[model samples]
Structure formats: C-alpha cells, structure tokens
Target chain A: MRAAAQVFDEYGLAGSSISKIMTRAGTTQGAMYFHFKSKENLARAVINEQAADLSLPERPEGLAQLIGLTFFLAREMQSNVLFRAGVTLAVEQGQVGLRDFSPYDMWADLFRGELEAARSKGELQDDVDVAEVAQLLVAAYTGSQVMSNLLTGPDRADLPERIGRMWRYVLPGIAQPDRLAELREVAERTGPAA
Target chain B: MRAAAQVFDEYGLAGSSISKIMTRAGTTQGAMYFHFKSKENLARAVINEQAADLSLPERPEGLAQLIGLTFFLAREMQSNVLFRAGVTLAVEQGQVGLRDFSPYDMWADLFRGELEAARSKGELQDDVDVAEVAQLLVAAYTGSQVMSNLLTGPDRADLPERIGRMWRYVLPGIAQPDRLAELREVAERTGPAA
Candidate 1:
C-alpha cells in the first residue's frame, strides 16, 4: 500500500502502472496479484485509507475544532506522503475514469457534524444551513489545496496560511457576531500550537 | 482545436494520445503536426486559450461585475463543451506532469483587477486586502467547480448556484455593510439576465 501510494503520488493513476508499482515495491507479480487484484483496487484502497494518518489531538467540538481540523490537514498535506498521495489521486482520479466520491461524502458529513455542534452551542448563526456549508467547505478546501499545489509546488507550503485566509473570509457569514473575533484568531493561528 | 479540446476534456492529458486527437480531428497527421508539433504543445494551446470564449456583456466595473463574471463562467461551464474541456485539462494537467500555472495566474490577476476597482468604489471595507481576496476567490471558485463536477457531474448544473452561495459567505468579510444586502441579492440571482 505504501509503495502504491508513492507511485500514484509521483505519476498519478493514469500515469502509474502495475509494473512500476511492483518494481517500486520490490514484490513479485504473483504476490502482488494475490494481495490486490488490480491497479484500480490499489488506488481505491489508498483513497479509502487517506485519513488513517490524520491524527488530531482531542479538542472541543464546534467552529474552533473545525478550524483546527483544517489547519491540521494543511500541515499534514505538507509532511505526509501517503496522505498527500491520496489527495493527489482523488483530484486526478477523473483522468483514470474513476468516479468514487466516498471521500468527499465522508468529509462533508464530518464537517456537517461539526457545524451542527456549532449551531447547537450558539456559535453559528440561526439561519446557517450546516449541510450546505459543510459541502462548500469541502469544495473550498479541495480547491485551496489544488491552487496551493500549483502555485507553491507539490509541498503546498502556503496551504495553512491560505486556509487561514479562507476562514477569515468565510467566518463572518456564518459565525455569531460575538464569536467572530476569537474564531478569526483561532483561524489565523498555524499548526497545533493550541 | 475543437477536436483536441474534446479529446483532452474526456481523456485528460496523459490518457489522450496524438493518434486519438488526430482521428477525432479527422485530419491527416501531417496537418495536425504542422499546427502543433507535440501533444504538450496542443495541451498548452488549449490551456492558454481556455478563457477565449468567456464573454461578459457590458456591466459596470465593481463588485457586481466580478460577481457577474463568475456567473457567466458558471453558465458557460454548463453549455460550452470547448470551455469545459479547457477547464478539465487545466485541472488534470498535473496528472501528465505538466505544471503550467499561467492559467491560474491569469485568473488571479483578472479577479484582482476587479477587486481593486471594487475597493476604489468603496464596495469593499477599508481593511480588506484586495490581492489576497482575489487569490482566495480564484482558489474558491476553482474548488467549487471541481466539487460541483464531482458531486453534480461534468455538466456542473449547480455551479452557478454554488458560486452564488460562495459569494454570500465571503462578501460579509470584505464588502461594506451598506452593500451587503444588494450584493447578496445579486449573488443569488442566476443567469446573465441583467
């Protein structure tokens, strides 16, 4: 799985081949076939397990936790190859004709849960729709990472800062007026410093 | 060019072959080679000319015009195959190891210019940074379309509405309080019926 992730990361799904991955993994074809039937299956496994390495320390659930989650992802994207490869494959999956949207759906649900908690605690505005905002956050985060990859390189060095800027622009529209300043401060802080 | 756009759109850069493009174009290899020496060159042409067909009618330059431009793009992404093809290739270019960022840079600059105009007209708050907002807009718009494509499909039927939602969430962070309601109304409206 790790070797496949590396190959998929560097060459993308369409550009990656079983032979290349097998060579990189130093495994025989028969053994590789025994474990995974096809390249697509390997790719899917990588996509499904993308969040395995994304460990966030325990924190209160609400808008601040949501902000912290995004920050953690931004930092992970820079440092974790397997996680980064999964993201790269997800974005490039269309090229290989793979349309599995489970990752996106899973993320939206996770964010919606966070937003719902925020609303329950009076951190969110009364009229804010948690589901729609959750979907939008997923989309915005996806695009921000892609743009960072293109403009800043594969390392995505500026993603954390970019996400911070995103929160500053988005928080005012959803969060309660009283929580705005503190939430914006939370959004601006980089890494797991909290 | 149209045939190449269609082929690139469906197959992406890596999966697309010179022979497939030649067959799609219904032209001799010599003729195709005469215009574009390589597949990379053809892909570059498509990327560079992605916005050639994005025509916006006469509108006052400010926040409204910026909003109008995004709407126009959303509508185009639905009906215009060539335009959609260009966008698909741009997003999928990294799969083929092509990292040309001129398309993204062009978009950021174009958005930044509109934002500068908006700031000058007092449509934006005094503390807002036009350049950062402009880049964020580009990133958000890019992500929104990708998510729409993934969740909604290639036609992107919901993109205009989604972009409208984005503006609603973002405007409050930068726009003057007096302009919020009017801009939010403008953002919610679909199509080019101004």
Candidate 2:
C-alpha cells in the first residue's frame, strides 16, 4: 500500500505502473499480484487504508480535539508519504478509473462527530450547522495542503502554517460568541508548525 | 496552449506528453517544438499564460466584487480548459521539472486587491488583515476546487455550489458587523447552483 501510494503520489494514476510499484516495494510481480490482484486494486487498497497512520493527540474532546486533529493532519501530510499519497490518490481518483468520494466523506463524518461534541458543549453557535462546518473544514484543509504541496513539493514545511492561518479565518464564523476567544486561543496555540 | 491545458487537466503533468498535446492541438511536433522548445517549456508557458482567459466581471468594488470574482472563477473553471489546465499544472507542478508558485501568488495578490478595496470602503472588520484574509480565500478556493474536481471529475458541475458553501462559512469573520447581514444575503443569492 505504501509503495502504491508513493507511486500514485509521485506519478499520478495514469503515469503509475505495476512494475514501478513493485520495484519501489522491492517485491516480485507474483507476490504483489497475489496480495493486490491488479494495479487498480492496489490503488484501492491504498485509498481504503489511508488513515492507518493517523492518530490525533489525547486532547480534550470538542473544538480542541478538532483543532488538534487538523494540526496533526498537516504535520502528517508533511512527513508521512503514505498519508500524502492517499490524499493525492483520493483527489486524482477519476484519472485512475476509480469513483470514490469516500475519503472526503469520511473526513466530513469525522469532523461532524467533533463538531457535534462541541455543539453539545456549547462551543458552537446555535445557527452553525455541524455538518456544513465539517464540510468547510475538510475542503479548506484539503485545498491548503494541495497548495502547500504544489508550492514546496516534498518538503511540505509550510503546510502547518497555512492550515493554522486557515483556522484563524474560519473558526470565528462557527464558534459561539462567548466561547470565541477561547476557541481562537486554542487554534493559535495548536496552530500549524506550532 | 489550449491543447496542453486540456491534456494536463485530464492526465496531469507526468501523464502528459508532447505528442498527446500536439495530437489534441492538431499540430505537428516540429511546429510545436519550434515555438515551445520542450514539453517543460510548453508546460511553463501554459502555467504562465493561465490568466489570459480570465476576465473579472465589471461589478461594484469591495467585498461584493470579491464574492462575484470567486463565483466567476468557479464558472470559468467549469467551462474554460485553459484556466483548468493552468490550475492543474500549478497544483501538480511536482511532476514537471518547473517549480512555480506564481499562480497561487498571483491569485493571492488579486484577492488582496479586492480585500484592500473592501477595507478602504469599511466593508471589512477593523481587525481583519487584508493579506491574511486573501491568503485564506486563496487556500480555501484552491482546496474547494480540488475536492469538487475529485467528487465530480472533469464535469465539475458542483464547483460553484462548493465555493458558495465555503463563502457561507468564511465571510462572517471578515465582514464588518454592520455589513454582515448584507454579505450573507449576497452569499445566498449568488450561491453555487442558485
């Protein structure tokens, strides 16, 4: 999966080949095929197992958790080839003959859970729809990483800073008025690169 | 340029070749090479000339102009191959030998101009930094397009809607308190698919 993700990330779908993945993995065709069946199948496995390396910090639940999760993702995307590969594959899936929105959907669902908890804790404004905010966060984070990746390529050192900047612009619209100051504080303290 | 953008958009940078672009353009390799020198040069030209097709609407200045421009971009990316190609090439620059952040920087500069105008007109909150907000918009828009392109593929039918959704979550934080209601109204009326 890691090798497939790396190949897919580096070359995109149409440019990647089974031989390249095998060489990257240092495995024989028969052995690789035995596990993944085909190139597309290997790609699928990579996409499906993308989140295996992600682990959010043991922070308090609610908005802080969401903030920490975003920061963690930015950091991971910088250092973790598998995570970055999964994102690249998920974004470029159409070129690879795969129809999948599950990656974004799964992320939205995860954000929703965190937002729902925040709502229950009165961290979110009454009018702020958890699902909508979740989608917004996913979209913003996804785009930020893509831009950072494009600008800096493999280093990805600027990703955390970009995402940290994102939360600053977005969090104000969703957090409760009274809780706004604290939430902004949380965002700043946990901000990208911090 | 059109042919190169289309090929790049469909296959990404690594997957694209001079012959493919020439075939798409209905031109000969010698003719293409005479002008472009190499595939990388052609790709660079495509990235550099991306904004040629773009024309912002003659609308009122300030935040409304910014909003309209975002909507306009979504519409263009849906219909304009050159614009899409430029964006694709810029985002996937890692595959090509060229290193360019000019595309994004240009976008940020454009957004900053509108934001500066908005601030001058008192449409923005005093606490807002035009540069920071501009970067945020560029990042959010970049991310939104990637996700929309991912979920909907080349059709990109849902792009305007996704961007509209993004505005809903982002604008309140930047608009002046007195102008918030009007900004929200404009967002809904100009919203994607609306």
Q: Count the backbone clashes (under 3 Å) in each candidate.
A: 0, 1
For the predicted complex of model 1, DockQ is 0.70
C-alpha positional error of residue B17 in candidate 1 after TM-score superposition, expressed in Å = 1.9
Model 1 over residues A37-109: C-alpha lDDT tens digits?
8888888888888887777534448998999889988888987878998887787777657787788888888
The list of candidate 2 runs beyond 4 A from truth reads A6-17, A56-60, B9-16, B57-60
Least accurate 10 contiguous residues by lDDT in model 1 chain A: A185-194
Tens-place lDDT digits, model 1, residues B10-118? 7767678889999999999989999998888888788888887777544438898899888888888987877888877788777656787788888888888888889
lDDT string, candidate 2, B1-194, tens digits: 88888888777666688999999999997899889877788788888888888886444378988888899888888888888888866765555546688888888988899898898899988888888788778888877887777778776888898788788878878998799889878877776756
Worst 10 residues of 1 chain B by lDDT: B185-194
Candidate 2's TM-score? 0.91
- Candidate 2 scores an fnat of 0.53
Error of 1 at B176 (Å): 0.6
Estimate TM-scores for all models: 0.94, 0.91
* Clash pairs, model 1 backbone: none
